[model samples]
Target: MVYDLNISAGELRASAGAADTLVTDLRPVLKKAVDDLTAASSSLRHWTAGPRMAETGEGWGGALGALRDNLTEHARGLRLLANGRDIMEQEVLSSFKGW
Candidate 1:
């Protein structure tokens, strides 16, 4: 197995910036989707369902809620990765003192 790693400070910064932008752009959309799903789930309580159908609706709502939570967490992780890269860039610059 062979591994080739090549990355400059400017590239790191640019990639980090792009990641930050992506996280910023997606977070709000994900948040709104979560909110909408929660609202819809709440409204589902008003609908009349048969014994089996009611259980199905409950399961569906739970799945939506879980998906929303996962998306929210994913956004958070993306932001963290971007920020960590930025921090690492700073640390490298400080260590070199010539960059």
Candidate 2:
């Protein structure tokens, strides 16, 4: 039995690039959303549910932060994988130089 494995470094790099672009584009939007939520919560301070709204906003901000961090790490991992694959491929090709 033989198993074939194929990995495309270019595709992995492209995916990483896309993730990076998404994070870049999303950063400002996430910040604005959190800021808006905080502002809204502040404006409702006199209401009975003001504190609850603030708490909910905080939770959402935290979740968004976590999502951003996870995506960054994913992009980093993809880049590392692509680099490692590239290095391995170079090494393998060089091994055949004498043949």
Candidate 3:
């Protein structure tokens, strides 16, 4: 059985653009939150206040930081995919351009 994904390159481009814009808008706020989390984690560690609690804070901070990084990577991938679609479409339509 052959299956078509029913995906549209134009839609991909639009979605990617929207994602990029949203991420750009949220960057500063997210960064500040991550920074605050890390700082709190560091403070907890310095005070030697309950090893488990400090560790948990550090873990949460790390996870949040990783999440931010993943979002960046996802955005990059989306743009790349969108651009790839455009390139492929251009190549496919090249023959008709002269007419």
Candidate 4:
């Protein structure tokens, strides 16, 4: 059985661009959320649940940071894949040029 793999470098690059944009857009929003959470928790410091709230905010911030990092890595991987695909396609075409 012959199997064909169809890959579009343009689409891969586009997806990578989209991921990059998402990360960029999320940065400020994430920062604002973390800052707000921290401030809110500080205001509640006199309450019994203040420390817990702070901890929860920290956890949320860490999770958001991890998500941003993952998205960045994903975009990098996609870009690399697109570059590799373009190279492979070029090599294949060059090989067939003399035929």
Which candidate number has the best TM-score? Answer: 4
Query: TM-score for every candidate vs. truth?
Result: 0.52, 0.88, 0.59, 0.90
lDDT score of residue 12 within candidate 1? 56
Q: Between the candidate structures 1 and 2, which one is better when assessed by TM-score?
A: 2
What tens-digit string does per-residue lDDT give for candidate 4 at 1-99?
977677688888899999999999999999999999899899999997788789989999999999999999999999999999889989999999999
Segments of candidate 2 deviating more than 4 angstroms: 1-5
Question: Which structure among the candidates has the greatest lDDT?
Answer: 4
Tens digit of lDDT per residue, candidate 3, span 1-99? 999876776777677677677767777876676567566766677566645555665676677667667777777787788788788889989968988
Report the C-alpha lDDT of model 1 over 34-76, residue by residue, as the tens digit. Answer: 5665565566756653434556555665675676566556656
Q: How displaced is residue 75 in candidate 1, in Å?
A: 0.2
**C-alpha lDDT of candidate 2 relative to the true structure:** 0.92
Check candidate 2 and list the clashing pairs: none
Cα lDDT computed for each candidate against the true fold: 0.62, 0.92, 0.71, 0.93
What is every candidate's alpha-carbon RMSD to the true fold? 6.3, 2.4, 3.9, 2.5
TM-score of 3: 0.59
lDDT tens per residue, model 2, 1-99:
977567699999999999999999999999999998889889999997777789988999999999999999999999999999999989999999899
**For model 4, which pairs clash?**
none
Clash totals, every prediction: 0, 0, 0, 0
Candidate 3: worst-modelled 10 consecutive residues by lDDT: 46-55
